[model samples]
Target: MNRPAARLLTFQLPLAAFLVFLLFPFYWMLVTALKPNRDLYNLTVNPLWTWTPTLDHVRRLLWDTHFLPWMRNTLVISVGATALSLAASLLAAYAIGRLRFRGSGVLGITIFLTYLVPPVILFIPLSRIVSALGLWDRPAALVLTYPTFLVPFCVWLLLGYFRTLPRELEDCARVDGASRFQVMRYVTFPLALPGILSCLIFAFTLSWNEYLYALVFLSSTDQKTVPVGLATELVTGDVFQWGPLMAGALLGSVPVAVAYSFFVEHYVAALTGALKE
Candidate 1:
């Protein structure tokens, strides 16, 4: 084979295998979501594909459970936490990347270090703080707690993006009598749109998919987010509601997929540019 053909042959097999491995779970979920329990368990039928598709699982998950409220709570907490994280990250990234302050390197490392700490370790102290603040069993608890990790990660991401920009732009804006905040608002932010969107997407995804914090912070049925809600409510002791569980899992992943699809180009470009710098 020619070199190009040999390279194509080399890449395609692994790519196809990787794609199948990654996508099989989603495919299984989709199939199971539409399959009746009879076909799902029947040894006679093909497990990979469903011959008879039904919306029963989807209908039951939607109407027979607290799915909508869980989705709403997840949305609210994710958006709130993303917004808060982005605001803080933008400021922190700018300061560390451009301000040239004393101990700024140490401070940035310290901030990023906080992100590395396991949530399992921090939740005990956080739970007490949440309870003391009267936020337990409420959506507000998640919105507040999510930022502890989100902001650090977002700041680290934005800091790399911020470092890639030309300092002269901010300097020129400053020379024009623009204050630091004014320069950030009028100059830096517009140029860093891709990075900002990337941070927003990351922070939102983290908040939306978080399970431990949601489980620990929220106790009420109405307050639980999608991940916690589906796992806890769909499984009754030893019995698992496989149909509705698969249905809920499929539905729960839709928002993050849509969000990623919308921002994927910008996110890719941001990472590329940051890496190039």
Candidate 2:
């Protein structure tokens, strides 16, 4: 074979296959959402394509379910959690990664170790804490609880990123008599933007898709996140509502998809930087 043809087979064909593999779920969801009930249920019909398309499922998902409220709750919780976690993680990472202190290394490792602990093991105690705080069935509960996992990972990532930053710049600022807080606010924070953006994306995505904590803490239909709401509200026992379910799933994924699209470069750069440390 010609070199150009060989290169095409080696790279382009695999790239195309990988793209299809990643995107097939989305295409299936779109096709299912658009499929008419008759075609959706008909055993003889092609599952991959529908001749007749309808927006009925989308309409049903929007109007018939508490999807909008769920979305709002999810957005509020996700943003709140991400903001809170980032603030805490930033301070913690800066202190551990930059400041010279005893036990800082041990503290950093401990924080990252906390992230490895499974959420399933923590939810029961967290549920009680949420209830005791009278935050049950409220978005604030998730806003608080999500930070448990988010902070540790964010701290770990930011710690690595902070280590990669030039310490000499910070020393120069210090020599100029800039206070620690001022130095961070002016020098380190701006340089750490990529790592911060990566943490924001990770925290937001985790909070957005979290299910167990949402299910345990939020009892109201209006208070649930998309993941919990879609699973519990869309299905009626053994029976499933595939069309509306798929529609809801597709709609629910858009914000996260948009977020990744916008910040993906920073996310990649941050991960690469962190891994180097």
Candidate 3:
């Protein structure tokens, strides 16, 4: 017992240090967001607090700018992408997980590898296509293009989660007069819900935080997502409006952060080396 206790004591310090290092930037962002624009001119390495904290940055960003439209655009795009990705991934995962078909294994790999393809490789061509389709600079462009990235990853994730589920459960559902679709809807989906939902959150955040595609495919101020709008509108040439920028950063992160806070433990468990639960 003392040996295990001693090992834990030795490990705890380094682990705690690593956690502080990981979380420091977020803490810094929060601190900077609350600091008055006047004090931002001065250098402060301390993240704990400064001489004083204020809400003027957050207030002005909310009341004085077009941040509300940016936020709305982000919400609409991310939610639409999440829904489309989830629906598409469910069908694709079900096909690969439960059905036997020619070239299924090869197709699965192709789908996952598609996720690894960088946006940089496709953005130039995608922009041309969006322009050709009359979606360039349109919010509708995001409602379509974000899915290309979202579906592949979500399908891959859901496939793995569905694979881990007991085949017996699905088989039982089928024998109980359920069709293939019904089995997935009732048996597999419910059992795989945690990991599936985790991937859904990932897809939503990916679309929400995405910048390069939004910057390329959208140029209109009213159509910009938070990531692009905040960068373009808030910061003029060579001028960093630190206060409002920080405020926008904080607000942009809140939804994903809140979602992560709620589901992080579940996500950790699901992806952990342990598979039992």
- What are the models' TM-scores? 0.92, 0.92, 0.88
Model 2 C-alpha lDDT per residue in residues 1-277, reported as the tens digit of each score:
9998998999999999999999999999999999999999999877899888999999999999999988998898899999999999999999998886999989988988898899999999888899899998988898888899999989989988887789999999999999989999999999998888899998998888898988888887777889999999999898889999999999999999999889888777767766665
Candidate 2: segments with Cα more than 4 A from true spot: 1-16
Worst window of 10 by summed lDDT in candidate 2: 268-277
Off by over 4 Å in 1: 1-9, 269-277
What does each candidate score in C-alpha RMSD? 2.1, 1.9, 3.3
lDDT of 1 by residue, 1-277 (tens): 8998887789987899999999999999999999999998789988888878999999999999999999999999999988888888888889898888999999998998898898999899999999999988988898888999999888888888888789999999999999989999999999988888898888888899999999998998988999999999889998778999999999999999888899888768766764554
TM-score quality measure for candidate 2: 0.92
lDDT of 3 at 219: 83
Residue-level lDDT of model 3, residues 197-270, one tens digit each, is 78877887788889998999888788888888888998898888887898898899998888788888866764
Which ten-residue region of model 1 has the weakest summed lDDT?
A: 268-277
Root mean square deviation (Cα) for candidate 1: 2.1
